[model samples]
Target: MELFVDLQIASENQADLPSLTLIEQWVCIAIDAGSSKTRKEAELTVRIVDSEESQQLNGDFRAKYKPTNVLSFPFQNPPGITLPLLGDLVICKQVVEKEAMEQNKSLNAHWAHMLIHGTLHLLGYDHIIEEDAVEMESLETKLVLQLGFPAPYNEQE
Candidate 1:
């Protein structure tokens, strides 16, 4: 539970949707939910950006010309440094809020889910394939629920 979150607010868009404490909490939940204990004392960066910035990064890095709710960039440490830097997470506040409203999810819950999702991605969990998707999504659901949030992928009623 000794994780440190370096929060960076690059945009004055959304009233700091997920406060630093909440971000750290969800990141810790996701990290602790993992099988490896290596990330017990990890470090990562969380940047809140505008839609334009998100779209730029997404397009440049992922070849997608849209703003994503959350994007994860895992760190690749060099040979000598023992820094426990995991990676970075870029969150688009506008997209997150819009998605929450559209998906009928509580703003905070969706924020927590997105933060958890990005943290898991930093921890090397992905839904690129069927099996990996199941495992990653299941883990996300369990962690979110344990953190007092509803299942993120529940069918919209």
Candidate 2:
């Protein structure tokens, strides 16, 4: 599978952001574990922004007026158009860093989790319902563990 990741840094603080290679690897891992298609070409963007942009997007799209860790916007193609576009993931660098520090997790590990979670969202995995949450969280744990990171949910809870 050929995957393209467009990394966009809109945040002034680039302190703990992961590299494009690591971001691509995390996205690929999630896609491989969640997507049904194996050999299709896909592209996604990872846009890192400050809390203000994140809060605006969250308020606009989700109606929550707070800065969120990550927001996934899945691309919806027209009926007859088959594009390789997956979607865009807007991550709040400040929130993520604060979360990592609060959760006592490595910066890279949390970043990987966010990317994997967002990519899974792009592939139609969600945690709104209990069953789906279990499935999605289980897959996420498996993938994160495979990457040698601590279990994210356990730490969060």
Candidate 3:
């Protein structure tokens, strides 16, 4: 798996996030769960944006008019390609930080959870239906636990 991360946020605090190695591990886990067969090579872009940028993207793409914690824009192209372009993940740093503090979870853990969630979305996982939500959440729980974070749904009070 080849992961490319571009931190769009200019804040110095963003530099304190988990290393690229950790992000790669989490992406691989998400890809394994999402894909029917293990992918040989994958390419993904993760962008850490601020609340304003996130809100714009949400409003433009989803018509939500609000900043979301994470957004995944998956790509579909011809098959039999050597490198597969999965999609892009847009994460709102402000929302993530606030949610981490409100939920009493470590910043790193929450970030990891969001990244996993977004990656799953890129892999074509959706939580719109009850059964699908259960399936997606189950995968997320297992993967997040492996990454040293508590189950996201279980963390809800």
Predicted model with the maximum TM-score: 2
| CA error at residue 154 for candidate 3, angstroms | 2.5
Against the true structure, candidate 3 has what lDDT?
0.81
Ranking of predictions according to TM-score: 2, 1, 3
Q: What's the TM-score of each model vs. the native? A: 0.93, 0.97, 0.88
Candidate structures ordered by lDDT, highest first = 2, 1, 3
User: What residue pairs are clashing in model 2?
Assistant: none
Question: Scored by CA lDDT, what does every candidate get?
Answer: 0.88, 0.94, 0.81
Clash pairs, model 1 backbone: none
lDDT of 2 by residue, 18-42 (tens): 9999999999999999987774788
Q: Please report, as a residue range, the 10-residue window in candidate 1 with the lowest summed lDDT.
A: 32-41
Task: Return the TM-score for candidate 2, rounded to 2 decimals.
Answer: 0.97
> Model 3: clashing residue pairs?
none
Candidate 3 residues 9-88, lDDT tens each?
53335755666777777778888777887776788888788788889999999999999999999888767654578888
TM-score of 1: 0.93
